[model samples]
Target: MAVRSHSTRVQSFSLSGYHGKPTRGTVTIREFNREQRMRRALEGLGKWWGVALLSVFIPVAHFVLVPSFLLYGMWQLCQRLGTAELATDAHGACPDCGTEQTFELAPRWRAPQPVTCKQCHRGLRLTVPS
Candidate 1:
């Protein structure tokens, strides 16, 4: 008896079907490409639109709605094309400002580096004892 590993299984997928999760790499950390980020920004806008219509009494509504859309567009463009960088999860926080903002990682913006904090505008770096 042999144990099978997850990635080892040869799952056959059809032309019109999905075989496995389309997303790749580790999920704990969030990574984004241009298309993916644009999609997110648009989604944020959509959510704000819904909130505006449904939650009239929402106190945070006024400040949140427009900002969501703006951040989305800005982030979408922030990510440079053909670049690879490491980013925290979408809900990740900035160590400097303490704002829960995910960084837009891009190669041209400087690849081979950890994602930056959007709010604090600081580059996220791994510390090593020297």
Candidate 2:
């Protein structure tokens, strides 16, 4: 595996609830190059394969564990290879409750994803401003 380097940027995003004005927020976006993506995919594969190898000593459990890990590693490899950008962190105020706080975002940074407010516990939608 090659040494991996990722470029990151902070971008402004929008948060909107069912009934309220949208709120502005910032998100940390990590962009992966081809080499970085390959490195990440290989790392995932190696990690899962390592687990699968260890599971071989678990007697009868190896039958299930090994196959599951092998398949999961392939799936992760595809996912990592396809993913070019990831959302690492997000911060914004709840549109409904007007409380400001950090938000837990999904790893894949696609717009119009569903998010929950920490203070109000209400469902909100996150989007990139056009």
Candidate 3:
């Protein structure tokens, strides 16, 4: 009987659709809208006189609710146009330096190749199991 040793090496890995983990900075449309609504409500309460005056013509509730909904709609449009802050995942740390270097992943990228390390400024490559 003869024994043979074989090794396989994968040079590149697909980073396509790499929706890596979402970080705290990532914002969803719903979250954004919620925050905006809260801010508007707080402002209306702070300037109680203005709100009371506005309530004469239109309900104070409508004054705050209408604009917030309009802004939310605008934000949704911008999100569809890829211009708004969305829940986008980011890449992990550098393999070489192990430093906290945050980077946005491209739509498509090949991994496990020599990429310049942001922290060390040296060629670094990360291998993934095939």
Who wins the TM-score comparison? 2
lDDT of model number 1: 0.41
| lDDT rank order | 2, 1, 3
| Candidate 2: tens digits of C-alpha lDDT, residues 29-107 | 9999888888899999999999999999999999999999999999989999988999977999999999999999877
Comparing candidate 2 with candidate 3, which one achieves the higher TM-score?
Answer: 2
lDDT per residue as tens, model 1, 8-123: 11111111102221211111234455565556556655665555555445577747765565555455444433323333333344445556543454423222335555665555
Instruction: List pairs with backbone clashes in candidate 1.
Output: 83-107
Q: Per-residue lDDT tens digits of candidate 3, residues 24-55?
A: 21111122234444454455444554444555
Sort by TM-score, top down from the best: 2, 1, 3
Q: How displaced is residue 103 in candidate 2, in Å?
A: 2.3
Task: Note the clash tally of each candidate.
Answer: 1, 0, 0
Candidate 1, superposed: residue stretches over 4 Å from native = 1-28, 56-130
Clashing pairs in 3: none
Give lDDT: candidate 1, residue 110. 28
Q: Model 1 has how many clashing residue pairs?
A: 1
